[model samples]
Target: MPYYENAIKKMLPKTYLRQHVAHEIYVALTHFQSLVPMMDKYVYNDGTMKNLMSLTGTIPVMFEDNTYNIPVCLWIEESYPQTAPICYVRPTCEMTVLSGKYISSNGEVMLPYLEEWKNGECDLVSLLQVMVVVFGDFPPVYMHSHPEPEQAPCWLQFHRQAEVLSRTDGSLYLHLASEDDLPFQQENETSC
Candidate 1:
C-alpha cells in the first residue's frame, strides 16, 4: 500500500485536472489485490518515452471449475477516467499471445468495454471485471509448447481455447484440451 502510494505520488504528481485520479487508482488496487503498482518508462512506437504508472500482475479467470491467472499490465494516463488506460496482455516467457478478436497481435487488449469507455460510467474495477468475463470466453494466451532454436523461447491455431491453471503445489503442468474434454493447465506465476 505504501509502495503504491509513493509510486503514484512520484510518477503522477497532484493536479487540479486529475484530482480524483489518485483516489480512484488506490481504490482499484485495494479491490484487485493481485495487481501491483509501479512506475516504469514506456516507449511508444514513435520512440518517445514517458514515465508511466502501471499496475502489472495477473487476474484470475475461471474455466471448467478451475481457476487460471492471466498476466496483464494496465498503463494509466495522466488524465485517467477521462482517458482509458492502455491495457496489454503481458504473457510470460513460457506463454504465447493468442491474437484474436479480443487481443491484438502485439498483445494489446481490444474490448468493447475499453472501446466505449465513458469517464463517469467507467472505472478501473469494472474494466477488470469486463476483462475477466471476456477473457473467459476468449483467452488471450497459451503455453508455448516449443522452445526457440536460437536460445530465446516463444503459437498454435485451434478451435479450442487454452487455459493455464495454477495450484497451491508447485509444478510445471500443461493440458491441451478441447472444450468438451477440457482439462486444466498449470500457470507458473504467482499473484501479488
Candidate 2:
C-alpha cells in the first residue's frame, strides 16, 4: 500500500475525523482504491478545494455532540465545483449556525465573498479563512429585509438560499433551503 493509504487507514481508526458522512461517501465511491487520482482531478483542480484542504487538511472533518453524537452530512459534486459543497446539520443540535441559514445542496454558503474571490479581489486562501471566521459566528436567522427585492441582483437571488454551516462544537454542515420555500422571517421566538 502507498503512504496515503496507510495514513488514511491509520487516521480512520484513530480520530473522529472519519465519522463525517462525506468521508464515508468518498470511501464508498473510491472502494479502497487510491483517492489521489480523484483528489487530483476533482479536488486539486478546484482552487477552492485546495484552499479548503490547506486550511483543514485532507480529513476536512467535523464532529457534533449533545444528547447523541452524530456526523454532519456534507457532500461535494464536481459539476458545481466552483460553488461550495452542500451540507446538512442536525436540527436537534445546539449549534445554530447552520440550522436556519439557507445552504446549497453541496453545503456551501452563497456569499458575495466567493464572487469577490473570483474577481481577483482576494486569493482562495484568504477567502476560505474569511469564510471560516465569518461563519464561525453566523446567526441562526438570515435577515432578508436588508436586500430590496427590486435591487437584489440575479446572482443574489440565485444563491439566496445558500449558506455555510458552522457548529458550536467545532463541526460544520452546509444546507440550502429550496427556492420555492418561503423566505425566513425574523421573530422574537427562540428555540428551547
Candidate 3:
C-alpha cells in the first residue's frame, strides 16, 4: 500500500492540475492488484515521444470456458480525467493480437466507454471493468499455435508375398521370393 502511494504520488508533481489523480490511481490499483504503475516513454504515431505514466499488466478476460490474462498497457496523460487514456493490448510472444471493431491490428483498444469518457463520471476502475466485458465478448488476442514436434519418418517395406491358407487345420503361411529380400527403392516424390 505504501509502495503504491509513493509511486502514484511521484507520478505527478503536486503542482499538477488534477489533485485527485493520485487518489483515483490508488483506488484503481487497490482493486486491480495485477497492474503496476510505471513511467515510460510513449511514442505517438506521428513519432512524437513523451514521458508518461502508464499501468502495465494483464486484465482478466473470460473467454470460452476459461479465463485468460490479457496483457495490456494503459497510458494516462497529465490531463487525465479531462482526456481519455490511451490503451493497448500488449500481447505476449505466445499470443497474437486479434484485430476487430474494438481493437486495431497494432493492438490499440477503442471502446465506447473510453470514447465517451466523462471527467466526473469516469475512472480507471470502471474503465478496466468495461475492458474486461468488451474483451470477453470479442477477444483481443489468441494463443499462437506452436509448430508440432519433428517426428522420425517411419519407413515401411511392403513385399509381394504369397499366402497359403490350409482348410484342414486353419493354418496360414506366407512365402516370399528371394528378390523380396532386397532393400526398398526410394520413391522420387516431389512437393511444391
CA lDDT, every prediction?
0.77, 0.36, 0.79
List candidate 3 segments past 4 Å from native: 1-3, 148-192
- What TM-score would each prediction reach against the true structure? 0.69, 0.26, 0.72
Full-model lDDT, candidate 3: 0.79
Q: Please list all clashing residue pairs in model 3, or write none if there are none.
A: none
Candidate that would win on lDDT: 3
- List, residue by residue over 1-192, the lDDT tens digit for candidate 3: 467675677777554443477777788888778998888999999999988878899988898878999999999888887988899999876688999999999999999999999999999999999999999999999985763345221232233443343444665433333333543332321112
- Ordered from best to worst lDDT, the candidate numbers read 3, 1, 2
How far residue 77's Cα lies from its native spot in candidate 1, in Å, is: 0.7
Best by TM-score: 3
lDDT of 2 at 156: 56
Per-residue alpha-carbon lDDT of model 2 for 39-85, expressed as tens digits? 22224325555312111122121223212222232233332234444
